[model samples]
Target: MNSGILPAAVAGFSTGLSLIVAIGAQNAFVLRQGARRHAVLAVVGICAASDAVLIALGVAGLGAVVTAWPAALTVVGLAGGAFLTCYGVLAARRALRPAAAAGLTTQGTSAGSVRTAVLTCLALTWLNPHVYLDTVLLLGSVAADRGSLRWAFGLGAMLASLTWFTGLGYGARLLGGVLARPAAWRVLDSLVAATMLAMGIMLLARTF
Candidate 1:
């Protein structure tokens, strides 16, 4: 019995990690907050906890209900796409201004405020349609057939979320020195802008 459960748990861990390791809005926000060393704990906690809740719901069979209501994901996709496009534009604007990027890296700004950080983290997590597809529909669908070991699969997935968020939020500082430079900041922001823009376009395009 334990042997059968172990494979499912491992599969859950790998799947959960794979789904989240991509460069997405939530990750970009978390990395920025982590690099800024501002409200890192709050950002990481929110991300991990949100993932855990989503995974649990998925494992508990919420995925079927969500899949039944495609309209819900459409709404989320529309909102999330708009938000990502706006954020991408802001990032692009910042990248164009070397001084602004440099200042943001050094002096910081109101965007780093705890309230703003937490709110942004929440929005990034909850508003994204992909999160629903991956966490609820995909993971839930897979876990539903795990028989008695379904919860074990969920527990493993939840652990993966916690580990990934903790590492990302805390480990971001390793690149602090590189991002401190204006040129490097430009590169980072440019990548972030492109990523956000592409993702937003993809989401919006899919809806049409």
Candidate 2:
């Protein structure tokens, strides 16, 4: 609310948006599911909610714990990188598979079955040290400096996550038909593989 806090809130929102707007595994999954029109809204909702909780925790001073545990952060980075690499390999394999005209179908309309999406989103959000650095440490530090307006900064960051995820999920669903193409799948797989490998290499490089 205060004029002094406006800049911090805007900066936090921009930071959060930048980190999440990328074509990461989580976003790819959400997009694929959205394209399939299978529980797209629910998936987005889960992701947004999870991010809000994490960001809130960060703004509430949980960043201090993370700041004190550099070793833990390293472990999380390694694990997250490994997980992403594995996921990338799987996606590449799927893409390389023979194209079936039938494509993916929403055989089961179980929008309420939020277990898989929720768990995946949670890991993508909380298990990655980069997330802690971006949202918890960096954003939290800036928000903390706002004194009483820390809550406003946190809200802005939280809204950024919600907006990005919702747009990604819905936007991807709108393109499910085109992306279902065999050639499109191949291209997507290649991109995913490259992205994952690059991210892993970067993480490993940082350890040195």
Candidate 3:
């Protein structure tokens, strides 16, 4: 690796870590799947693969298109915010519903199959505008300034995604049994709702 590549890699890793560390919809979904021990690998695989593709595209100059099209970002941000808010409300409702919450368990299929998990993971990763902004626009712009270090930076970002999703998908499983409790489920639901709402509000606030 070139001398400049080290800084680029570090920057990329930091960017990727910051974006993935947040408790977004995708991360929540991944954790839920992990808790269920259902299609965890597939979900992580989809997330990592999607990140790789997006990071590659960004590093290859697609960030310019995103930068030029401010309207696109606005539209995407609005859509993402709406989705997050709606999802958050649903989660909060579940949290508040005593009867319905009682039957909730940490283990189950969200869509009945690994294929569905893969598709859902892909949507969660790709459909969110924030993902594009973080991985493609921000990381790409920074990587672009690195000349020959761009590829290394992209690789580091990809690795960061892989590490996070993998850890989320597998690590959360350890708490599955405990989270399977009704009260625990309610708490988790509440947490997820709060996280989603916060992220949605933050995104909307940034847009205007």
Q: Model 3, range 110-182, lDDT digits (tens) per residue?
A: 5667776787677656657878878888888888887888988888889899999999999987996797677
Reference-based lDDT, each prediction: 0.87, 0.73, 0.81
lDDT: which is higher, 1 or 3?
A: 1
- Cand. 3 Cα-lDDT: 0.81
The better-scoring model by TM-score among 1 and 3 is 1
What does candidate 1's lDDT look like per residue over 24-121, in tens digits? 88888788778777789999999999999999999998988888999989999998888888889998998899988888655544555778889878
lDDT of 2 by residue, 1-208 (tens): 4676777678778878977888766677677667666777777887888778878988898999988999998888887777776766766676667453235543466544556656666666665677778777777887788788788888888989998988887877666667656677566666766776666666666754
Cand. 3 TM to true fold: 0.83
Which candidate number maximizes TM-score? 1
CA RMSD, predictions in order: 1.8, 3.0, 2.8
Which residue pairs clash within candidate 3?
none
Which residue runs of candidate 3 sit more than 4 Å off their true CA positions? 1-11, 106-119, 201-208
Off by over 4 Å in 2: 1-11, 100-102, 105-114, 204-208
lDDT of model 1, residue 8: 84
